[model samples]
Target: MTEMNYRTALVTGASSGLGRGLALWFGKKGVKVYAAARRRPQLEALAREARASGANIEPVELDVSEAETTLERIRELDDACGGLDLVVANAGVGGMTDGRNFPWEHAKKVIDVNVTGAVATLSAVLPRMVERNRGHLVGVSSLASCRGLPQNAAYSASKAFLNTFLESLRVDLHGTQVRVTCIKPGFVKTEMTANIQHMMPFLLEAEPAVEFMARAIVRGEDEYGFPWPMDRAVGLAKFVPNVLFDAVASKVVL
Candidate 1:
C-alpha cells in the first residue's frame, strides 16, 4: 500500500462527469490514462486536453455494460500498455423510482452496469495485477450507499453492493501489494445529477471531487467519503430512524 508511481490508469465512463474529472486529474499528475466511454468524439476531446497538458492519454470507446466489448478493450489496453497500474470502475447510472414502481428493465440495467460491469472490469484486470503483484483498484460508490433512499432505490442498492464488495476485496488483498478502495461521494454537479429536480446538500463541483478521489487512491485509503458535511450527514442518516429519514428525504429537490 506504499505510495507508487502509477504509469497507466484506466477510467470507465470517461466521456463526461466524474470519470472525465478523474482522467483529467490523473493526467495532470503525469500518469498515462486510458479514458473509456461510449462516445468517441467526447473521449477524443478529453484525450486532446489531457495530451495538451503532457499526460499520456488514450481515448477508447467502451460501454462497460457490454461485457464482451469492454473485456476485449481491456485486454487490448493491457497488451498495449504492457501493464495497467490502476483501474477505476466508475461507470454507473441513476434512475428515479420507488422500489415497487421502478421499471424492472431499468432496475436490471442498473445492476448490470453498476454491479456486473464492475465485477467484469475487475476480473479482466485482476489476474494481470495478481501476476505482477502490484496494482490499485478503485470502485466509485456514492453517499446514497450509506442508507436507502426512497426514490433512488436501485441506484442506492447498486452502490451499497459496490461499497461492500470493495471492502471485502480490501480485506482479501491483505499482505499483497494490490490495493482496493471504495469511494462514496455526495451529490456533485455532473451530467448525472444535472437533470435531477432535487436539492443537493453539500454538493461539490466535479474538479474538487476528482482531486479528492485521486488523492485517496494515491494514499491507498480503504474508503473515502467526500465533503466533510456530507460524510457527517450520511453518518447521521445511518443512525436515524427510518421514519424520520423517509420524511426528510421525501422533501429534497435538487
Candidate 2:
C-alpha cells in the first residue's frame, strides 16, 4: 500500500454537511483545502472557521450541477494549488418523494448532482492524477445506497449509482497510484439531513463522521461505511427476501 500524506485537497459541496466537515478535518491536519459550493456566504463562513483552526482554505463559489463551470473552476483551483492530492465529490441533494408520486424533476435533479456531478468532478481531475499516478478520489455516497427506501427513491438510487461508479473506477485504476474510495455513511446530522423530516437510525454528528471518513481516506480503503452498526444492518438487509423486506422496510416509520 502506498502511503498517503496529502498536502492539498479539494472538497466540493463544502457549504455544509459532510463536505464542510471533511474540509475542516483536512485543514486541521495542515492540508491546504480548496472548498467549493454554490453559496458564497456559506463558503466564506467555512473559510473563516477553517482559518481559525490555522488551516488554509480557498473558498470557491461553485455549483456542481453546472458540469462545465464546475470543471472549469476545478481546473483553475488545481492550477492555483499546482496540483491536487484528493478530491471529494460530496455535493448532493435529496428528493423525498414516495412511491405514490413519481417526481421526474426531483429524480432528475438527484441524478444530476449525485451521479453526473460526481463523474464530472472525476473527469476534471482524473487526467492530472493519471499523469502523476498519485491522487485519491472519494465519493461521499450514502449507506442508503444499500437499500431503496419508499419515500427516498430518487436519493437512494442516485447514491447507489455513486457506489457502483466508484467501485468500477477503483477497478479501472487498480495498477495506478490514483486510488478511488467510496464512503457510504449512514444518517448524519447536517443541514442536508435536517430536512429529512423523519427518524434516522443511528444518526451521527458531523464531527465524528468526519473522523471516520478521514481515517478511511488515510488508510486508502476502497469502501468505507459507518457507523459500523448501521453499515451491518443495511448490508444485512440486502439478504432479506423481497417479500419479507417489503413488509418490514415498508412499515419503517421514516
Candidate 3:
C-alpha cells in the first residue's frame, strides 16, 4: 500500500450511483475531484452538493462510450489538475438479456462503455503516472466477473475483462509507486440494479459500498471483493465443475 495524500482524483459516471458516492467521499476528504458524466443537469446538481460541503468538485460532461470525447476530457482534466493522483474508471452498464437473446447493439454498448472506456482512461493516465512514479488506478469490477452467470452475459464478461486487465496492470506496475486495484462488489442497491428481478445475495447500499471501495483504493489493495459471504461464494464457484456451474446458473435470474 502506498502512503501519500492524493490532491486530485478523477471519477467517471459520477452523476449517480457508486461513482457519485466516490466523488462525494473524495471531495469531502478535501481532494480536488473532477466528476464526469453525460448528463449535465445531474452532474451540475452533484457539483452543487459537493460545493455546499466546501469541497472542490468540478463537474464535467463526458460519455465514456465516446472514446475521443473521453480521452480529450481526460487531457483537459489532467491539465487543470496539473497531475492526477487517482483515477477511478467506474462507468458501466448491465444488460438484462442472455448472450444469445441479447441484442448485438446492447452488447456493443456495454463493452464500449465498460471495457474499452476503462482501457482508454488508464491509457490516458498510466504514462504520466509511470513518469512520476506515483498514483493509484481503481477499476470497478463486479462479483459476476469471478464466474459466468445467467442472463447478464455481456455485463459479466465485461467485468471479467476488467478483473484481468487490472490484475495485469498491477503486475506491470509492480515495484513502482503506481498501484492498481480491481474492486469486485456483489449486488449493490444502485439505480442500475433497481430494476433487476433476481434474488441478490449480500446486497449493500451505495454509500457503504463506495466507502469500502474508497478504503480499498487508499490502502492500495490488489483486489477488493465485498461481503464476506459473496466473496466465499465466488471462491467456491471458481472450483465448481463447469457443468454444475452452468446448471446452477441457468436457474438464476439476471
**The best candidate in terms of TM-score:** 3
Worst-scoring 10-residue span by lDDT in model 3: 1-10
As for candidate 3, its clashing pairs are none
Error of 2 at 41 (Å): 0.7
Ranking of all candidate structures by their TM-score, best first? 3, 2, 1
Clash statistics: count for each candidate: 5, 0, 0
Among all windows of ten consecutive residues in candidate 1, which has the lowest summed lDDT? 1-10
Tens digit of per-residue lDDT, candidate 3, span 39-125: 889999999998899988898888998897788889788877888999999988986657667688888899999999988887787
Per-residue accuracy of model 2 over 71-173 as CA lDDT, tens digit each: 9989888888888889999999986767777788888898889888888887797889999888999999988898888788989988998988888889999
Per-residue lDDT, model 2, residue 230, is 93
lDDT (Cα, tens digit) per residue for candidate 1, span 9-77: 899989999999999888888788899888999999998888788877889888889898778889889
Query: What C-alpha lDDT does candidate 3 achieve relative to the native structure?
Result: 0.87
Q: Relative to the true structure, how large is the alpha-carbon lDDT of every model?
A: 0.86, 0.87, 0.87
Q: Estimate the lDDT of model 1.
A: 0.86
Clashes of 2: 0
Candidate closer to the true structure by TM-score (higher is better), 1 or 3: 3
Number of clashing residue pairs, candidate 1: 5
